[model samples]
Target: MLRIATCQMTSGPDIGANVQIAESLIRKAAREGANLALLPEMFTIMSNDPKDVLRLAEQYQDGPVQRIMSGLAKSLGIWIAAGTMPLKTDDPHRVTNTMLVYDAFGQEAARYDKIHLFSYEGQQERYDESELYVGGHKTVSFNLPLENGLDIRIGLAVCYDLRFPQLFRRQSGIDCFLLPAAFTTNTGKAHWEVLLRARAIENLSYVVSAAQAGRSSCGRAFWGHSCAV
Candidate 1:
């Protein structure tokens, strides 16, 4: 079996601070012999203000986030399935919520932009990710070569995408699913675990999820139970 780890964090608006936390967690996971590590969505920044996210958006290849993840993967000699980060797009008002995977050698192996944007309105809270992010149009999957001379197919997805089973269904022959999420307290408490387990059972593939926990700089509380099944 492939050893994997998922990290939960209380990310804030400071990109540098968040990266440091992620690095520390990744190092811990590596020391424990984890072959792969998955981080939470928006692990580099979490803010309710659109300006904060926009200010932090960077080009996929040239951004500090990518550089940090790549260097960490290479240094630790482990694969890193980085969580969703804001990547600059053609539209200045919007960015892509993208996931980047790095191989042990620090080369980017695959990238998946989040396809489903989350929008919720309730008496307690309201959120509309579409205001800041442009949803991606494609499904992405790649193979991870294991030490046993076996290659495992991994499908990539982000938070809201977990609610859309059709997306996972489109990726056939995947051995596992990686979901990086920042689920709200209300919805996560009600649906997170059930949905994750359902995806694993229905697809007959293992599911790994990393999530943001506790309160964020935006005053939003996240459900922090990052897990795998």
Candidate 2:
């Protein structure tokens, strides 16, 4: 069996600090003999202002975050399923919530933009991800070659996409699912674990998830509990 790790974090407005924490966790995972490491959604920054996200968004290849992940994956000799990051889009006003995977050699292996934008309105919380992110239209998956000479088909997905089963269904022969999320406290308490378990059972594949935990600098609470099933 392939050993995998899911890293949870409570990201704040400080991008540098968040990156440091992510790097540390990834190193720990590698030390523990994990073949692949997964990070939580928006592990780079979580802010109360949409403008901050826009300001920090980077192009796919030019971003410092990409460089960090690539270096770590290469150094650790492991695959890294980086969590969602804000990517610059053609529309200056909007960004894409993109998940990027780096191979053992630190090369970009695959990319998947979040397909479903999260919009929630409740008595205690309100969020509209569509305001800042552009939804992606295609499904992405890749084959990961293991040391045992086995190739595992892995599917990529982000927070909101987990809510849509059809998205997972499109990835026909995936052996595992990597989902990175920053789920709100209210909705996560109601649906997070149940949905993850259901997906695993339905797809007959292993599911791994990394998530934001506790409270963020923006004062939003998340349900952390990163796990594999």
The CA lDDT at 46 in model 2 is: 96
TM-score of each: 0.98, 0.98
Tens-digit lDDT string for candidate 1 (108-156): 9999999999999999898898988999999999999998899999999
TM-score of 1: 0.98
CA deviation > 4 Å runs, candidate 2: none
Q: What is the C-alpha RMSD of each candidate to the true structure, in Å?
A: 0.8, 0.8
| lDDT, residue 161, candidate 2 | 83
- Cα displacement (Å) at residue 175, model 1: 0.7
Worst 10 residues of 2 by lDDT: 122-131
What is the Cα-based lDDT of residue 93 in candidate 1? 95
Clash pairs, candidate 2, are none
Q: Any idea what lDDT model 1 has?
A: 0.94
